[model samples]
Target chain A: MNKSIIELKDIKRNFKVGNEIVHALRGVSFTVREGEFVTIMGTSGSGKSTLLNILGCLDTPTSGEYLLDGVPVRAMGKNERARLRNHKIGFVFQSYNLLAKTTAVENVELPLMYNSRISASERKGRAVNALTAVGLGDRLMHKSNQMSGGQMQRVAIARALVNDPAVILADEATGNLDTRTSFEILVLFQKLHAEGRTIIFVTHNPEIAQYSSRNIVLRDGQIKEDKVNEHILSAAGALAALPVPAED
Target chain B: MNGTNLFKIALRALNNNKTRAFLTMLGIIIGVASVITMLAIGQGSKKSIQAQIAEMGSNMIMIHPGADMRGGVRQDPSAMQTLKLEDYYNIRDEGKYISAISPSVNSSGQLIYGSHNAPSTIYGVSQDYLTIRQLSVEDGDMFTDQDIQTSAKVCIVGKTVVDNLFPGGGDPVGKVIRFNSIPFRITGVLKSKGYNSMGMDQDDVILAPYTTIMKRILAITYLQGINCSAITEDMTDQAIEDITSILRRNHKLKEDADDDFTIRSQQELSSMMNSTTDLMTILLACIAGISLVVGGIGIMNIMYVSVTERTREIGLRMSVGARGIDILSQFLIEAILISVTGGVIGVILGVGASFAVKYIAHWPIFIQGWSVMLSFIVCTVTGIFFGWYPAKKAAALDPIEAIRYE
Candidate 1:
């Protein structure tokens, strides 16, 4: 019923391999409303990654229109597109993509650096608040290499949430995490989604897709199935089951 | 794109690779040091020459015959064939500022005293020539006007000729020495003067009265040259003008015609030598400056490689909303830091090296403030010019591709 936050109409993307053109995406169309928790499912080479890149404004589609809110993405210049990517979209990669030498708080503060409107001290304060929200309050000063896989992912999530972007586009965010850690990340995503944030998760794992409200399966360069799932896990329910720590 | 952030990032990046950064700065260091040291040496020599020339009497001027001959033909006036003794007297009488005037006649020949014989120059001059040249007798009396009028065979012997002829013996004054088979009594022993700035031996000549040299030693001679002095240094130009007018009137030369002879003052010679040496020093410094440019190119090459190596980092920054100008500013700041740091170090080393050359090697060295500032400016410019293209390439990188780059 609400206006679509993202709209892609007959989008296509192609890659050149030597002299031959490889179609990464072919005439795909989709729309995501605000506060929607969606998952795109596909095996390797299914163009799910390419779709995520376009959604994040990191790359342009070869043809067709991609409109974020209302502005046509393909028509934006390099700097304008970068601004869009910085302020409108947040990305989570498979490897966490945390700067190795930087602290968790600094990693989250990166997006705020590009926003000239925010003062440096204010940006740092916001970054700290984002880290606290991700349950990384105690580990804000810890570096990526010092933290565990799950903690690093939380930091990456905090980084995604720092700029208060309209949407978070994640590509196989838990690909390197263990089963237990992946579940923990999924629980965090659910909590973020419940807080009125739009999330798009791209992964091949069926278990990961079960956490989202909607699922889209891609085969080769086209979508094979698009459906809504009513049985999505709730972060509050999951958190209530975990053991609570005693007050210091 | 703010300056503070850019500088912080650049400094951090350079700090990350300490060894590579230092090595990159080495080129500028060597270039600046070489330029400064070479220029110092050249300037030092020039200053030393000027000082030596200043020590020679400032008012002294030399007039050589046929000096204005353009090609190979003589350009003297018809009547100028005789630069007579009477003409010298007339010029002395006419010029107000004229302190002394001497006609010089010289020939190179072997001088013998007992078994020791040394080849040397014989100069025939009046008593005024000694005062003009700032030469004084050490032990015996000098030639006087009476000596010139009487055509006496008295002479002044230089230290070198004395050492060669009279080894460790007594003073050679009053001793008779044969100069080219002509016997002359030694009247005075000139005080020791090592050499002129041009490396000419000033202490290896014989001096005698001009009339005696003209009539007795080198017979049938007009005049080889004339040496004159002004009462004061400031009056040198006026004295030269007065002498020129007197000579022109005596020679009956028209105003349009060029003078037959050349008059050179010691001050003029000093200045000319100074400028020549200054030019030579600057030229050497410029050649050395080329090395700094080469060093800058080295920095550029390394920066390009660094950009390629850190493509992923560039992409990460771009994704975080860093503008191309921010990236450019960061890399450029890095380059300038390296060059400026190297320049500061190079200036220290250059000045130190110059002092080392001066004290240890005993060579004259002069280092100017302008040279140091110039080297610093050169170093900074080199960094920016050399680092521009690589920084531009880094800024232009595609975020998606760069992030994905293995």
Candidate 2:
């Protein structure tokens, strides 16, 4: 009975590559309810990136009915889509795309900079809160280059959470991290999800599907399987079970 | 995004590349500095020239006899004695704008005081000649009307003449000096004027009564020339017209005939020098302006490189809810900040350079407020003009491709 935050119906996308129409997404359909942690899994050439882009409002499906937070998205213009994306979606990339040489608090403040209604002081307050929420309270003033990969990714997550978007859309968010750091980031995501935050994590790694409540597998531009996992693995439990490494 | 936030973002980006930003601003700095310094030099020279003309009596007018065409043979202006004492008297009596008037007749002679003799021109003039020529008697008194009435043998000696004829440095006043075998008592010593811009010695002269030069020396009935000063500098043209008409009537010239005497004023010479200096100023500014254009091109080039280098940053901002226009403004503001900062520094450096030139190089320099304002506005415009294309390119980028850019 939960309200659907994202609903895609028969979404199709085509690209013309040198006079050949290549189908990137063919008749894809899904609905993600509020507060539900969903994983979109696919191999290469399976249109998962295209689906993530459409869900993030970075791209529009060629023909589809897309309702994000009950607002139709496919009919919106480029700028309106941008505004919708700003207000309703937060993006976390695999590379931890924090602005270089910028402090964590400032990087977290980036999303709110686009919102004119927020004053500078309010933006700083929200950024500080978001960073604290991501367990980066002590590293608020640390620059991106001065932090490790896991710390930089946490800052990126802090940026994604600052705007209080309807859904946090992560694209292979922990792909570049080592096994231990990946579990640490996954644990943070699991914690955010437990706090009733809607998350749509897209990746090619099938092992990540066990951590989410629902899984949608894409194959050859179509959804091959959509199912629910009754037993969701806790990333925090997995991180604690790993052996402690020798001190460097 | 709001302007200030975008500005802060742009500022941070520039801070990341401080060395590159400073190097980029160097072109605009040199260009604006040269423009201000050049304009200062030009204005300074023009002012100095005008001041020198004012020192020579800004409103003084000279009436010289024009060359006469006699039976297909042209007579020299000095040989033509059309300007007479009658014209001088007429101008003094009828000219409403005339403040001072004198008749001039000169004879070159050797001035002897004891064993010292100096070759100098003895200018025969009335008492008013001192005011007309802006000359002052430093010691003793000027000749009175009695001296002119009696065709006085009294004279005034200048500093050069004093140094030559009275080498012993005693008072030249009341001392009799012989000119061309005629002994004349020196009534005063004129103040030293040193040399003029033309390298002419201004203090090497003797002043005697015009009547004496016409009767005793040249033995001529007609005067050589006349000098008149207008009541004010602005009344020079009117004074010249009045003198011309009076001289024409006195010489009995017809309405259609040209005047036998020629009139000239210091204002004419001043305007000529002013035009020359203005031309030089414009030429220097134009040359400096070319460098400004080059500086603008340099901005465009650096902005392009910055856009290319920060593709990932632009993509990240866009993903974080920044619109295309926000990205564009961020880059544009960065460019403007560089230029405006350089402009401020350029203005300070230019003013400093102008003073340095005035002190070190001994060249006159005047810093005009408008010139500083002009360079500032120009540098701002240069920022916008050169920053547009690259910012547009950055804004139009595809976020996906930009994020993936190597």
Candidate 3:
């Protein structure tokens, strides 16, 4: 994959907290090419969340040149930014953020409601395809409250993919799950990565970084490290090593 | 997002808290209901007064004997005996505008018919009194001109007198009912006239020839009052003017002196009643409007609460590519739906309540179609007006801050 889906240059963000200037991101810059599985690692107050917010188009950098698939994001108007978020970027939250009591297919169809070009039947069809792609074909009718945490996350993933966005951004996607369930979700990400999907993961867990193709570590509002993970952890291999579940 | 889909989502959100939604709508429902009911009551009374005026003969007039003032006190006109039988004759025969006339003499007495007895007032009038008073004989026939000339003992009994004299609902015509020990044959029975607004039973009287009543009952010579009717409702004032001029010429009263006779018309009573009822309707409608305002405030309060409760939902929708206008429209639609729904329900309830009052409570109720339509329009405006603040608040929220809100 030669094309870059996201590019940032000298992205600076500051805030005034009671006569104090807090620099959340001090001129950080990076580029993530298409089809890359990149993980951004940081501890608390490292400004990774702020950086993710800018990437998700939920916030704009105070002064920076940020581009998503060659479109200038910082200069976009509010409605334009919203349209970009709807069509290009997909988000997966640590809490899964799947609408409670909403069926998986319905949740997946949410993003399509904003896309007026899509017909109702086409929207439903695409939602089903997306859920099936996330290995949740049988759980299309299942609501978040009725599903296990892992299953709910999968439903959230289906929601993120339903619009066929250019890049999928996950923030602490496995932070709430146990070790076995984390690996199962990570393996699903690996499968998606192998299908030529661009994925950006943000987490504080160092162990999770080893599973991605590249890692970028942030320290004190600046990038401290950026390199490929030479010894990649195979999530499927890790999942296979765990003992089989006992029948209920 | 499309309006239909946005409203669908809004409807679903409201459905999530069914009890709250219903409670919120109660305010509007009550407001609309009170507005409709108050207007109906006002309209109903106005209509009833008009009906009474029509029943009293719209074109009719009354001439009362003017009272003789003793110092600052004016005595009853009936005791003055200024109106004479000749005035009634001249008005009936000479006046072009006058259609009918009857010299009236009133006497109250206890009537005895067989073993049954009733106390009723007697009115002495000629056959033309029926048309002048807008009364019709429902049984037998009216007394002839010979009855008045010969001072006949034939008389007509009104519905209440019939009910009292004949308990079994038999035809009272040709039956003898003695008034003050003077026996008279019932010549006819008048149709029922129901009761007046003053709680007076209008059909509680018996009618006889004025000459007979004056000689036998009251032992008087002069007529008490003269009942006259004009050719049409509009001509009543002219007929009264003609009678006054004719009476003044005959009585030979000086131009400076006050006349001894007074001419009255149903229009005077009608206008007075209409103005009184008009003031009452306005007063009642204003009071009812206060309830509608209270209902609107309830809507505003609930909408504010709803916006606060659904902060996270608003954030979610905003983040999902919903523009500020989209968020605004969603919340606006929610408010409009609640109010319009409430308005529709209130209309049904108000109409039902009015009907119930009319049928069960035996009260007059006139429901104006415009009032129902007005309530609908008012409620819609109320929803939009009250919902605007909360909807704007929701639309103006910071998506990130909202998402993080508990």
- Candidate 2 lDDT, tens digit per residue, B1-406? 6788888889988998899999889988988998899999999988887877887888999989988899989888999878777777788899989999999999998888788898999999998999988999999989888988888899998999999987788888999999989989999999988887567898998999999888888999788888889999999999888888788888999999977888999889888988998999999988988888799899999999989998998888777778899999998998999899889888899899999999999998888999999999999999999999999999999887787678
TM-score per candidate, chains pooled: 0.82, 0.96, 0.90
Worst 10 residues of 3 chain B by lDDT: B8-17
Tens-place lDDT per residue, model 3, B10-35, is 77667766888899899999989988
lDDT for each residue of candidate 1 in B130-201, tens digit (9 for 90 to 100): 888888889889988888999888899999999999996887999999999999899899998789977888
Best by TM-score: 2
Clash pairs, candidate 3, are none
**Compared with the true structure, what per-residue lDDT tens digits does model 3 show for residues A43-122?**
99999998998988989999989999999999888889888888998888887776656788888888888777888899
TM-score of model number 1: 0.82
Instruction: Give the Cα lDDT of each candidate.
Output: 0.85, 0.90, 0.87
Each candidate: how many clashes? 0, 0, 0
Query: Deviation in angstroms for B263 in model 2?
Result: 0.8
Give the alpha carbon lDDT tens digit for every residue of A46-123 in model 2.
Answer: 999989989988888999899999999999887787788788889999998888888999889988888888999999
